[model samples]
Target: MLTINNLHARIEEKEILRGINLEIKPGEVHAIMGPNGSGKSTLASVLAGREDYEVTEGSVTFNGKDLLDLAPEKRAAEGIFLAFQYPVEIPGVTTINFLKTAINEIRKYNGQEPLDAAQFLKRMREKAKLVKIDDALLKRSLNEGFSGGEKKRNEIFQMAMLEPTLGLLDETDSGLDIDALRIVAEGVNQLRDGKRSFVVVTHYQRLLDYIVPDFVHVLYKGRIVKSGTKELALELEEKGYDWIKNEVDALEIA
Candidate 1:
């Protein structure tokens, strides 16, 4: 569903991602684990069409189309969803209204008529229940004054509402308690179909326990140094990132 070949990126003048190559198929889940400053988030940002990152080299294709050519909003319109690690609070926009606008915007982009109030509300309510989002919280301003669990829950709620073809979850498990993690993973699992895919970016393997990945990738120093199955994530958690860092350093020396 997604392919990145020799993908090198930079922010300002500092190079971040250096020759990253990855291919993910539909119905598969891939996890990217790396330490801070290793360009894990930079890869996600670049894929989501964030403007700050400059693509110095390489190309990215999504579902056969060139992804880098699309604008950030265009990416969203084309079925790319990024569940941000830190969700920003919109103090004035209520959650329901915000989602309505987003859903209708996407629909309009797809050459479909906007969902009328009744249709939008019906779909939103169904998705909210699936994500276990409280009706009261959905009535409030988006992410404003919400607890950590609430923010994560809201993210999944939005994901369920959109039903994107590819979901890039950037550290969704951070700050989430085990119970919250279970609910979030369940929501993601529910959305998984034969055509949908996910790229889960995380630091800890605890999240992997709930959402098992088909391929586990270890990223160090802006490149994917190792790729393996779910066992790789377990091994990393047991040994810590320093082991991988040493291996990468040794490879560079060799």
Candidate 2:
């Protein structure tokens, strides 16, 4: 569903995401794990069409179209959903209201009719249950005063509501306890129908325990250095990223 080839990106002259090469087919889940300053989040931001990062070289194709060519909202309309590492609070916008507007806007972009208030409410209730989001939270401002766990879960809730073809979860596991992690993973698992794809970016192996990936990729210094199955995550957890660093250093020395 998504192909990134030699993807290079930079922010303010500092290169990030140097020669990232990944290919994800439909119905597959790929986990990207790396340490700090490894360009994991940079890959997510570039894929989501964040304007701050400029693509210096390389190409990304999503469903046969040039993904890098589309704007951020256009990327969303085309079925790319990015769950941020830190969900921002919109103090005045209630969750339900914001979701309503977003859903309708997405539908409009896709040439679908907007859901009526009753239909929207019904769908909202259904999706809310999927994420274990309560009605009280729905009534509150978006992410405003929500605990860290709540904000992360809220991102999953947004993903559930959007039902994107490809979901890019940028460290959704951050700050979440086991319970909150399970809640978010269950939501993601519930939505996994063997047709949608997910690229899960995280540093810990614990999250992979819940949302087991088809492939685990080790990213370092803005590039993917290793790819393997879930067992690779376990190895990384046991041995730490130093192994990966050593391997890359060996290759460079050779």
Candidate 3:
């Protein structure tokens, strides 16, 4: 569903993603894991069309379209959803109203009619239940004064509401306790409908224990240095990243 080839991106001359290449098929969940400053989140942001990162080389294609050519909102409309590492607060906008507008805008972009109040409420209720989000929270300003877990759950709830074809989760497990992690993971798992794909960016293997990626990739020095199954995550947990760093560094020196 998504193909990234030789993808290199930089933020004002400091390169973050260098020579990233990966293929994400329909129904697949790919976990990207690495130590700090390894560009895992940068890849997610680049794919989501975040303006700060300039693509210096390579290309990303989603469902046969040149993904880099599209704007951020265009990417969203094209079925790309990004669950941020830190969800921001929109103090003036209630979560329900914000999501309603977003969904309707996406619908309008696709030449479809917007959901009426009743229709929207029905969908909202269902998604809220699926993600275990509180109705009272949705009525409040988006992410305002919400706990970390609540914000992450809200992100998942937003993902469910949009029903995106590809979900990019940038460290969703960060700052989440075990209970919150499980709740968020379960919500994400429920969205796995055999056609949607996900790229989960995380530093810890514990997240993979819940989300269970089909493929695990180790990214280092702005590139994918290794790719394997879930076993790789276990190995990383057992050994940490120093071994991988030594191997890659040795190769570079050689």
Best lDDT goes to which candidate?
A: 3
Clashing pairs in 1: none
Provide the clashing-pair count of each candidate structure: 0, 0, 0
Question: What tens digits encode model 2's per-residue C-alpha lDDT throughout 137-162?
Answer: 98999999999989988899889888
Task: Flag regions of model 1 displaced more than 4 Å.
Answer: none
- What is candidate 3's lDDT per residue for 37-78, written digit by digit as tens? 999999999999999999989999999999999999999999
User: Which whole-number lDDT from 0 to 100 does residue 165 have in model 3?
Assistant: 98
How does each model score on TM-score?
Answer: 0.97, 0.98, 0.99
* Model 3 bad stretches (over 4 Å): none
Per residue, candidate 1 scores C-alpha lDDT tens digits across 105-191 of 999999999988888889988998877999999999999999998998899899889889999999999999889999999898888
Looking at model 1, residue 76 earns an lDDT score of 90
